[model samples]
Target: MLLPDLVRTAARRSPHAPAVRDGAATATYAELDALADRCAHALADLGVRPGDRVVLWTSKSIDTVAVMQAVLRLGAAYVPVAPSNPRPRVQCIADGCAARLVLADDDLAGLRTRPGQTLNDAAATPADCAFILYTSGSTGAPKGVSISHRNALSFVCWAAEETGLDASDRLANHAPFNFDLSVFDLYGAFLAGACVDLVPATLAFAPEALTRFLFEREITVWYSVPSALQLMTADGGLLDGDPPPALRVCVFAGEPFPIADVLRLRAAWPAVRLFNWYGPTETNVCTSYEVTAHDLTRTRPLPIGQACSGDQVWLDPPGADVGEIVVDGPTVMLGYWGQPAQDGPYRTGDFGRIGPDGNLEYVGRRDHMVKVRGHRVEPSEIEAVLATHPAVAAAAVVVVGAGLDSRIHAAVVPAGDARPTMLGLKAHCAAHLPTYMVVDAVRLVAELPRTANGKVDRAAVTALWAEAVVRG
Candidate 1:
């Protein structure tokens, strides 16, 4: 079943149940179902046809969820671009999907530069293209990943079944609509006939606001980036008072979790089940591992866990310590939208290996590894070290300080009152790493900027480096 089926099911099963929450505005299952139908009808009026692509360039809201379901219902493929994305990048995604329509908020709604007509309503689907998701371009140009209705149905059903999600689960919609994580929030919620709490993009990084929202709403399932959890766990004092009444499952992805931070959070919330999910946007959560008490401090690094329900995961160049991860399953996208077909398995640029326990654990991006003073350094290695320190709330490592022989620099977010000195951090790294792998400079910031998808913005960090050099 496509997303529409789930919406219809929720309406039938519990029409009066609260289906979505976005700040003051809330919609019951019946109301959400009606809104989606109205939006679908509106789109049909706009001449949108089956397989037509539409770009949703808006912030996360209950309205955004309705728009997504409306598009899928009409058999139109929705291509999502977060409002935080630069106009040029948004244009690149819209163009890549060959979108026939574009939906935006008041600021962007009037744009007529593209060919597609603006959607005033939602239409009905004929089972054509369901959505197109774009993944980061390590080779320089992003690729549009086309996913069909059948593909989405398979994964959503699997997720609902595996997670034991039901109508009682209140899933937090923290990830932007563009990110695959939203799939778990929207489709999974509808599949389980559960309520979805829509957190605005601006409020997502604010620990206090997020904590209050979760507690007040009694959110049962929390899903977001590890960095966000790190911030909440470190600076927000989120766990100081009574814990969230309903929090049960905490799912993290989009980046690696610090083994040290994981241990701390586990101590803080002994009852909450934490999971480390590993997959690219091209493949929406192909594998996940539940962090058991035994595995958390198993001496070996934590594994990404086993593959999801029906998904198949394997490492390329078998037996290698690290290699590109390959996924084969219904969840895998139908290839880059406009790129030529290359035979064989889908190669995720992410590098990982099968642990001795036969589980996958991510290492770092194949391209994220950089040569510094002729020594290959993985930014994650330095970032992981920084994360373990009591003072560091969050950390991102990037190549900074010009010249072809670029020096590694770190941008760290320090925890309150625990401002560790830059020299101290450098010395800390020196003890654990080689001379060349140490960060040349550590710039302590309040927080690192993040992409719409919640990963640290490395490009923005690099830009800050350039700005620093110019000012100096």
Candidate 2:
């Protein structure tokens, strides 16, 4: 079955059930379904057709969700560009995907012109591409990870089943639409005819507001990055008053959760099932580990645990020792956009090893790709953009700190006597990269350190930036 069928079937089951909620606005399943149909007509009226890609460049809202459903119903894939993205970066993605249309506020509101007439569902199949998620590329551009209808359904079905989602449940959508985490938040809720409460962008980082949204909305299942859980509980006092009776399952992914924070959460909500999910965007959550009370005795971070979601996850290069994590299953992405189809096991650049308990544990990355604030960032992508600056002769970027709290620092060599200012380079990056990928701190250097192989030593670049109490 197609991904859109989830909502269609749910609407059949409970037409008047609340499907989506954003602040004071809410859409019933029947309303959402009709809106999607009108949106499809609006899109088709604008020359969108089957197999074309449409870019949705807007903030996370009920309208954006409707547009996604609309795009899928038309047999086209939707590319979600984060609201935090700059104009240049958004255009880069739009151009990269050769998008047939880019929808905005006016476009979303234009759906009203079509009335409430329901359009027939497009003749789409399970193998059809449902969406293309663009992530940071090591080659200086964004890489589009193409996920098919079957690919997404495989994970979404597993998620709903694993969590025992039901029509009475309320799911909180903390992750933005651009991130893969939203797959569960949006589709899983739709599959079960449950209501999904969307957190406003303005209050996403405000601890108090987020915590209040969780309980006030009566959210039963919550899925987000580890940092968000940290901000909400540690600072927002999520567990201070009393555990909300409605909240039963809390899932965290994207980056490793600090053990101290995890232990604290478990201590407060002993009954809540806290899950540590691990996977890159290429694979929609290939593995999951449920946190148990035994994790309290552990000093280090928790293990990523065994594979789930109908994916085959294992370490490569035989069974000698630690190796790169590889994934092969339905959930693995079809391929990167503009590339050939992926026919074999996809090699995940992350390194991993089996623990004494026979669970897959994360090792350090084999490459420089890292997640900052739950968004995947490639240092080379930022460095490439910085190198384009006329004031800089060379550029290098390194991640500082650990896990989700890390900051990106860049060291650049001046072009002759031309000294690049921090603000200048930051402005340059702001124009080219997303807010999360932009370097947090900038430092000037005469030259970058290189090893005997003549490759720039990223570690030394990191050390030079660490030596700076002063910004460039």
Candidate 3:
């Protein structure tokens, strides 16, 4: 089925049902369907055609979602860039993807209302490009990951089927449209004829606001990086004040969930099904692990589980303890936008191993290892051990310099009022990791910096550390 068909099918099944909610704004399936039609007319008037790529440089809103549907309805792919990006950056992405047009907030609002004809849905096949999602260019310029209709549906269909989502399920969309995590929010929810509550960027890091939204919105399924959940539970008293009876599933990806945090959460929300979805943006959730009670007992980080979305996942080098994760299947992207086509199995820069339970265990990213004092160091190894500390709600390790001059620095978010002293955290690392891996310095933060996708932003952390040193 075409990606746009999700909305059309859902609207036919329940036209009057609540389809999307953002702040006080809401749209029913019928309204969303009509708006998409009008928006499609607007795009068609602008010369958008099949196989063309348009950039939706707008914030997450009911309108933006409608625009996305409109783009698909025309058989034109949409390239998503963070709305916060400046004009130059957006234009760069637009130029990079060779976008036919770049639509901002004003375009759809003004044009959709004055649209003329009810444009027919484009004759798009499964292989047609659906959208281009750009990476959070922390290292350098953002590269768009070109996703096909088949590539996305492989995962969306799997998610809806696996979760048993239906009209009654209220899915919380925490990620921005530019993030791949939002695919399930838009398509998966629509595929299941479910309502998706759009959490605004304003509440992205506001733990208290996020905590309240969960309870008040009666979110049944939640998906985001682990850091957001950690913030909500730790500082916002997510579970302290009331019982969140409606929350049934919590899906996290983008980064590892500290084992200690998982145990605490599992104990609190015993009935809530937890899933650790694993994949980079290019592969859109190739593997998934349902959190078992047995997982809480294991000391290691959570296993990324077996392949899903009709994808085959394996560690390269076959029998090695850990190696780069590789994927070959429907969900793998066609290729980077404006780059060479992915010829075969995509070698994910991430490293992992098949655990004794036959699940894939994440062994940090291949790029995560660094040379500190000429000793190979995995910052995540230190971060993992630090996460085990009673007073540390979250922890991150970063290398501050180059070669022999490099220093390992740690940033921590303390658990509530019980802040772990720098010396105490260092000692904890010393006890758990090798001498070389022990951090040279530690800094406490209310929360760790997060990228647009919600993963801990290591470069931002490094910058913050460096800025402080310069000030000193």
Best by lDDT: 3
Whole-model Cα lDDT of every candidate shown, in order: 0.78, 0.83, 0.88
Cα lDDT of candidate 2 equals: 0.83
TM-score of decoy 2: 0.80
Candidate 1 lDDT, tens digit per residue, 1-472?
A: 5567787888888999988988888899888777776676666667767778888888876666777777777777788888877889888888887777777875232221223332333344423458888877757777777776666766777777767899999999988877788888888888888988898888888888888877888899999998888777766777687667789998898898877778777777888888888778677778888887775566445678888846788888887888778888777666678886423456887888777888887877877888877677789878877777778877899986435668998998887778889788998888777888888888888788887667889999888877888999
> Model 2, stretches more than 4 Å misplaced?
369-472
- Which candidate number has the best TM-score? 3
Q: For candidate 2, lDDT tens digit of each residue in 242-347?
A: 8878899999887656566677788888889888888888998999999989887875447899888899998888795778899999899989998998887888
RMSD of 3: 1.7
| lDDT tens per residue, model 3, 1-472 | 8899988988889999999999988899988998999888878888999999999888888989988999899999998777788999898898888889998887767756845455679898898899999885545887888899999999999998887788899999999888889999888889988999999988988899999999999999999888888888877898795458898889999888999888778877888898999999889999999986877688877888999999998888988987889999999999988889988999988888878888898878778889997897888878889999999888889999988899999898888788798788878888888888888888998778877777888888999899989999
Better structure of 1 and 3 per TM-score: 3
Count clashing pairs, candidate 3: 0
For candidate 1, what is the lDDT? Answer: 0.78
Give candidate 1's total backbone clashes: 14
Tell me the deviation in Å of residue 122 in model 2. Answer: 1.5
